[model samples]
Target: MSLELANYEAQAREAVKMFWGNREAALAKQVASGNQDAGTRGAVTAGKNMDGFLALAQSLVSANGLAMADIHVQRRVLTLPGFFRPTKLWDMLVIYRGQLVAALEFKSQVGPSFGNNFNNRSEEAIGTAHDLWTAYREGAFGEDSARPFLGWVMLVEDCPASRSAVRDTEPHFPVFPEFKGASYSTRYDLLCKKLVQEGLYTSAAFLSSPRTAAGDGAYTHLSELTSLKTFVTDFSAHIAAVAAR
Candidate 1:
């Protein structure tokens, strides 16, 4: 792994761990103080997973020497002038370089199969894309050059050992109400298809081995996965090269 990759990974790991520490402490206190929901235990675990995803996403970008536009970006559009106005909000908008380069929604899961989880995420991405497209059309996003947009659904690998811990107290993990029981593979497949349809992502591929090349529709594993660091390094370089062009 390159020094840049290693540094980003370390930073990401620490940030995620800190996020979890604070979140878990809060939840635990709630439980200890008798204000906890049994169902919330699952949700807590899911939150940890989300922390990991967020950290990784940040790391992925930072490894390329890119910083998010701001930690928190909420841009709104109000249609109509006064009483009949409707407002639209965009969550966690980010910028890379001087251009509006990227946007992402992070997700996490602790289950064997995605089942409906996939659908909900897919729908969310679709809606986000729709909103972005609408905003672009309405001139809310400005008319410089077209920027890249993306949706990400990060999942925790479901190994046999972690399943019981994940399911003991929580009946269902946090799933989008609409997309219950959807498989991860299915979700990824559909998302990739939609991204292609909308011209958002050029390609997707599964990372079978550390040596796997980035290709069309590839789904890379996160754990024990070789070459991920290398892949990110290359990805960062590629993005920089593209931005230069």
Candidate 2:
């Protein structure tokens, strides 16, 4: 089976709709009017909007020989064993005959909060990888023989706030050369590429979409190294190999 991108434009638009819907619902129900939390808290409410991408991911698993029953998307069974933590909920997971096949995390970033969330996002991504790999090293996934494929996808909103250059202030020591004047978008692209280079993830994708026209399914890749095409190509190869075995 071949790896082909699904109708991403429709899915992306759905994600945007979900994001705004969740945030608006939260604002109406969760926080006090005119409070600082009211505006910002809603931003975190609709994170699951990106779950549509998981459907595309599921396609990869299905194409690779795993059946629908083998893949888990619901949070209940999506929990995977962790080293530092008892367990972590993953966005998507595939298991075949008690052997771990793949686990992926889908994440997104939207504007007005990029600055406040970038560091947290970075730490979360790295820490999750560390926990999973360490757990695998300790034989966390039962008697599984081969390593499980780990994937990360970052969908950032394409807006002025995210694309503008950001200043770096290194008070104590010098920051990395790549991030000296990188914008949030560029920083995320670097993060995706570096995660693969550092062997933290099997494949990673960096995507940008605009909220208003997301339904048009328009998204941009920051670089070839971190592009979704590359991620899918690598992941397809891995999954195809695993299925063959």
Among the numbered candidates, top TM-score falls to 2
Deviation (Å) of 183 in candidate 1: 4.8
RMSD of each: 9.8, 3.1
lDDT of each: 0.44, 0.78
The list of candidate 1 runs beyond 4 A from truth reads 6-27, 41-49, 59-91, 96-99, 111-114, 157-198, 201-245
Residue range 50-137, candidate 1, lDDT tens digits: 4543555555565554543333333352121111123334333445444445554544443444446655756765655666656555
Indicate the TM-score of model 1: 0.54
List the candidates' TM-scores in order: 0.54, 0.86
Determine which window of 10 residues in candidate 1 has minimal summed lDDT: 208-217
TM-score of decoy 2: 0.86
- Clash count (model 1, backbone only): 20
For model 2, give the RMSD to the true fold. 3.1
